[model samples]
Target: MLGPVAAWDPDGTPLPLGAPRHREVLGRLLIARNRVVPVGRLVADLWGDEPPAGAVGAVRTFVSALRRALEPGRPPRQPSRLLVTDGPGYVLRAGREAVDAWRFEDIAARAAGASPHAAVALWDEALARWRGPVLADFPTAAWAGAEQARLEALRLDAVERRADSLLATGASRDAVADLRAHVSAHPGREDGWVLLATALDRSGRRGEALESLRRARAALAEGPGGHGPGPALARVEARILSGTGGSAAEPGGMAGGVWDRAAAAWERSVPARSRARLHATAGLLRDLAVTGAEGLGEAREHRRDLVAAAEATGDTELAARIIGSYDVPAVWTRADDPAGAGELSRAAARAAARLGPGGPPALRARLLSVVAVESRGDAAADAPLPRAADSPAAEPWRLRAERAADEAVRLARRLADPALLAFALNGAFMQSFATCGSAARREVLGAELTRLAVGHQLPGHEVLGRLIRLQACAGLGDLAAADAEAEEVDRLATRDERPLAGVFTSWYRALRTCETDGWAAARPRYDALLATAAGSGMPGLSRGAAALVALVPVMRGDGLPGPGLARLDAGPYRPWLDPLLLAASGDAEGARQALAAAPRPPHDLLQEALWCVLARAAAAVGHEPVLRRARDELAAAVGESAGAGGGLVSFGPVARHVRAAGRALGGP
Candidate 1:
């Protein structure tokens, strides 16, 4: 049950299960963990949306085979005690110790209340039960998805808990290797990053700790939800930068001493029912704090429980905070979950109302900052721009976000708290992105952040500041500064074991070569960058690089292969690249249609390069209207190189594209 579905005899010999279908029956029963699974549910799960005429009969046959294998020695007349008939279905009747997965869960549950040393041993014993992925042999079965995800999450939690125990026992160095592996495999897990950084910092590897935080920020930003470093990472980073060792007292600051002390006091003073509710809320918050994108569904469940528990405690501030703290490090701001963001916004507003004018300024500032951040919902800095008519609807939120950010920064600065100021400044930066022409503003914000971060010795914030500055430099077409910043980023990334750190620098350099030399000369560089992006878990970068690699043949007039064209169709740059590919393939009308339908990418580091590509495509297809549009857009950065702005792929100078579009439109 922990790995591939199978059974073993009393002496550890493997017992042969009949067929795949028979094994699936056992697997389903085992997943129920000794509970009854109805025959109808089993049939529905096995067939999915369409069941055969005799699916119930097939299910019974499989169950019969499973029963035979489980009780080979049972007398013919005696009723089987193991696989007994229950209401509506069959029950496996396996005890906790009979199955590895159930035993593992039991051990984990016990470990929650154990001391550090005992917890370490228990976690080790539980983790040792896993041999591979859950239902390893049924990779594509629809029935396996939920159980696999649940068990895998449990396994991950076990590993993290073990690391926490190691940290608690002052074995920080011992925890680093496993934590590094955990973060590498599960880069999106903010808790993994937090624990890894804490372990590295406690081990006196301060540089690596900062690097881990930086990588965490980048990895989270690249996800579908496009979130920044959430509160958990931010708090851990602040603790590390303040030179607070990851003592057993803090252990990554996951649930700090303050919470523990307060909870203990409440237990002594409050009613038992209230104390129970408090304890439950605390447990839910801990779970929420550690969960990332993969566990968002679970996080939502915890959020609901915490909200209910918070209300039950009748503490207004606690309830507000609990409701506001649904800050899983994913999909918080993305358009896909508007209801979630709206809930958070309402929570923050409620918190603000409760705090009143006399509440702690820091708390108020933090709340304001959260509001500012949330106001940018669906307007992610790198997201594609909406149509012209939709722009007006977005302006009010942007202005409100700006106001909130300004006030938050003012309050933070008035307090002169570095951590609070960093938080405020981050919100300000996130809201700085407009529909277009935001590079200059980001450049200023980035500089201020870098200065503040450097002065306070906040290495994680410093890295983020530098990254923003690097993107701004590229957008502003300052190649020399961009190159220098890229070098620094590469150095920090290499020192800290962040494989994805050097991607930007590598892309920038390759694009430079592609612009100066030719496609043939830069082909190998693009190829290598593509491989690096894929291996570093950067699917976006990989797709961008793949598009560029595929274009090399097209640029040489050799035409793209079918697979290459198919790959091009799926990338973000498909709108621009489609026209170029179609024009090169002798389909002028198709190229024109693609150009007409293409929406402009959001104004960011990559906007100029994409526009330049569109400009070339327009010129190749002799589409004068698109040519004029491209020419006007490129004219803004005529002296700058287009591809250098985006490190992923380059298409030469902005001036060249502008001039080509001008000629196509019968201008200069």
Candidate 2:
């Protein structure tokens, strides 16, 4: 039997035995309806600290009386006819008309539809019958306290709504006053301050508005995410400090309902007529957009659909919450037009403004940042932007890497659909580590990574599984495993460019000069990678590799390697190609001094430092500072556009001069 719903039919005549104790227990049971109300909890709520002799008997007696009254015509032997037995207690299955509690909820839902005046009037009328603290007319027990809290929460809701209507209708001052009281009545809530601030700001009292936000922040910092503030309040506060919104949250990359396959999810999950899949789907979408769901797009979408569908199935309260996105940092990892990037950033911000409370905060923040960064014209991202899309000077091996890294970030926050959000994040992070080469990031991405591996994403979780092991192995200094992961990455490589794994392979090969011989030697696989990377434009690390490899082949000779040096200077790729050119000329003294002018890290790993050592030995070039900068880039390689983990590393050898002067540039 289903549990009791809120009672309706306010005019129905009251019936039966007048046992106060039984009425108290029945009210408690009705409130908790479907769930088990433990014996200890019931007793705690029933007797407080003072249970009389045989208090247990008293409870049984009350149960017996209530059953007899509710089911007078039923068999005397079946007490469960009125209250079904459950774990340690009983479940009351009365109709809504027989239970006032459920009826209260119905009234709340109806309030959303009513006119301001009608809504307030209707709820006030309904609330008038809450009648001395629900089940409160009985003993002061723990269960009674819990029941009171629940009903009080509803009462608070009424007040909040009243305030909402008032604010919308231009009674901002009144709304603030009412909300202040409402917040007090429901202390330590994040939404309260946001609401309070909104009302105050609307009323033209800006300082107090900010204060409200501050209070909320402080309170929420303590935990439970209780102090959930709304975006409107933050906007209001922003206006107070500046003409425009202050510190406005940056946008994300994924646009609005564009990705929302809500309709599709609904058709698939819901039943014939009474189907409720939309509710579940919407909720899941909201959560995926807001919290850390996964690294796959489809998984996130499915979860969102499930949430929406569930909400459609009579979970109005849940449905009401299913809205908007999170501020995951807007960036346009997609190497498209700058104008497009700007629009994407703004859209991301708007989407985040709509997000309520969600779990994927890290992912959300990252998404917004991706958009914002892109809009800023991430010249710092892949660098050499001018040559990226169409420069004969581009490197082939890095095309996929640049695209993959940028795409991964875009995809990460780039979703309104839960599954897309997850897959993208997974791809973004894995690709980020692989191309950028950051071990620290690799360390912290586990838990969220695991979710991507689970039901949150793909059927096999195979890609993510491999990616994680790859990250772990890299972090632990397991070179063998790292190389093993590289093998897998190679197996999966395709023609369009696999930025994630492909970049990992290419960069690793270039970093330590590992593939410098192959690229510099017979075939020019590395050189081919550079020449063909035109479609998506070269990524930063790829450009770095081009310059680095150009210096490789020139080092194949003896003494000063002068003849090898001539190969590089002859190419039209001169001004922009100076770094590699200077190093390979064996004017070791001249090159080191040239680099000393700008001590930024060149692309190669320790090879830069190795070049400095070699330059010092050659003794022709003089300045040590340039060598120092080159060495710095080589050794400490921080934040450079190099791979971090997920199977990307700098494993190439001493091609610092060899590959540059010969293959990539011209000769050999």
Candidate 3:
């Protein structure tokens, strides 16, 4: 199962597993994880859509041969034990220890939580189970491809993990040869390059380490998608170039070593620590923080410690950099933590003040950009900017954010660094929520960001740029371009193992289905998107999806169930749903009052969908004023699909909503 799918006798001599088809039958049963695989499934799996008249007979013959070979010493009248006949098919009753692949998987699973020494031994044992390519004898069998790929990925991961353990055990030089072979065999694996370079560098061959990184970039560029060296590799190269001796591995690969080096450097005396070392550590920690939710708390704690240390040393630039290093991809401008954002914003301001007016413009730009993004926290709502009386306060914050973003971009342009420009462009795009033409502004910024990210080989920023473009495309009604961007987003997310990046893509796909078909048809897709979002720890996306799931009945003019209305009221989209829910509940006056008091939604991705919901609610309650307002706001987007920008839900064509509002207002 681990390699060629062959069997051996108990004493060590190999037992011939009959011919190819016989082996395939055994392999199929084995792949079922000891469950019964019906003869019909085996025949279909072997022969696909078409099968011969004697296909069932051929399958039985193959299974009989496999049974005989597997239980060669069984009594003539005894039933087969290893490959026993079940109701309609055969079952491979092999124990876990009897199968190499199962044993390998068990070992790898255990190695995940083991100490370095133990992990290395376990990974070694796991790798030893693989003799060659998985299911090598069934190369042409379509059924084997997925399992083979899964096993191969596990093998490669084990190899990398073993190297990481070796590095941790201070045997970096010993891992060099294996890592070199790894990158050569799997050029597209960014982690392999990082490990190989780290091994070379730790072996006192800095030149070769640098060359390995260059080769990695070249190899990745030549691969199928022409992706550049990913963020982890870029951080590794930066650390190596800074001479910080930081471990060049992803957070999940060798997090202990990376964090230990960073902690040691940060604890050093001010005079002893170089700015380059501080930069390297900060970059490493920043990448770790954004890797997933598990590391976020620790990364934030370390960031605070580093900030305090920098403040003690009067290193304003370092403090500012540490405070502003969060570069997670954001769709909505709302802050996740209002209190934390305020604290960081104040810290950044203090750092800037300490630096005075003539400090490094680049550092100042970065601090200002962080402030701009953080100031979006008028409240702690995870959804888009809510419409309320206090929303007026958010207006001043939005204005201040725009001002700060403008200055940041100007300073970034002056510095002429592509990375800085990319950062500034992100802030600019985030703050591009002015009353009019916001989507156009975001589209332009998105294009510039994409170009800069591509030119500099910043794959993370490239994905961000594409996400911005994707939103812009959807908002601007360029469904074709939006579809392409969604496809590319999925590609990059898959290539980089960034599941969070695929959340938006999943949302867009479901929204497209909703537009083409109807809400009933798209319900399953939205449900799946909700699951993905929740699994990825994106509460805002999940909340919005849950709200949309509840609104489907309202859109269909069906009675809103109690549980559905409860879910609708629970999310941040409550304001947008209030009027709809009220009208559905037969509270016409309450519905009209809610629609009248509802301030226009912010000009973000969800604006169109929110407006459509409001319009429908107003029409249901005969609120002419609200209907006319919805009509006017949605007029320009007549040809577009509502909710396209947000990718959460859809109300079909915007024209439908606009026309409904117009009819309700006694116009067209």
Clashing pairs in 1: none
TM-score against native, each model: 0.47, 0.33, 0.56
Instruction: State which candidate has the highest lDDT.
Output: 3
Error of 3 at 166 (Å): 17
Residue 342 CA error for candidate 2 (Å)? 8.8
Any idea what lDDT model 2 has? 0.45
Task: Please give the distance, in angstroms, between residue 219's alpha carbon in candidate 2 and its true position after superposition.
Answer: 62
Provide the lDDT at 373 for model 1.
59
Q: Residue 545, candidate 1: how far off, in angstroms?
A: 3.9
lDDT string for model 1 (1-668, tens) is 77788898788888778988888888888888667899998998888879999999999888777777888887787777988888899889886688988888878876765678899999999999988888887888887789889989989988988899899999999999999999889887767888899999999999999999999999978865665556778888888889975578568865542355356656666787654565566556545433322333455445545566675676776765555443322111222234454455556656777888787787778777766655543342223444211212344555666777898899999887776677677777666644334566767877887788766655445655666777667666676777777777766555433334455567767765665677778878877776655554333345455766565444333223344565443455676678777876788999888887877644445566666666677777787766776667667666555645445555455666676667778776
Where model 2 places Cα greater than 4 Å from the true spot, the runs are 1-451, 458-479, 487-524, 527-531, 535-547, 553-580, 583-593, 602-620, 629-668
Global fold similarity of model 1 (TM-score): 0.47
Q: Residue 493: error of model 3 in Å?
A: 2.6
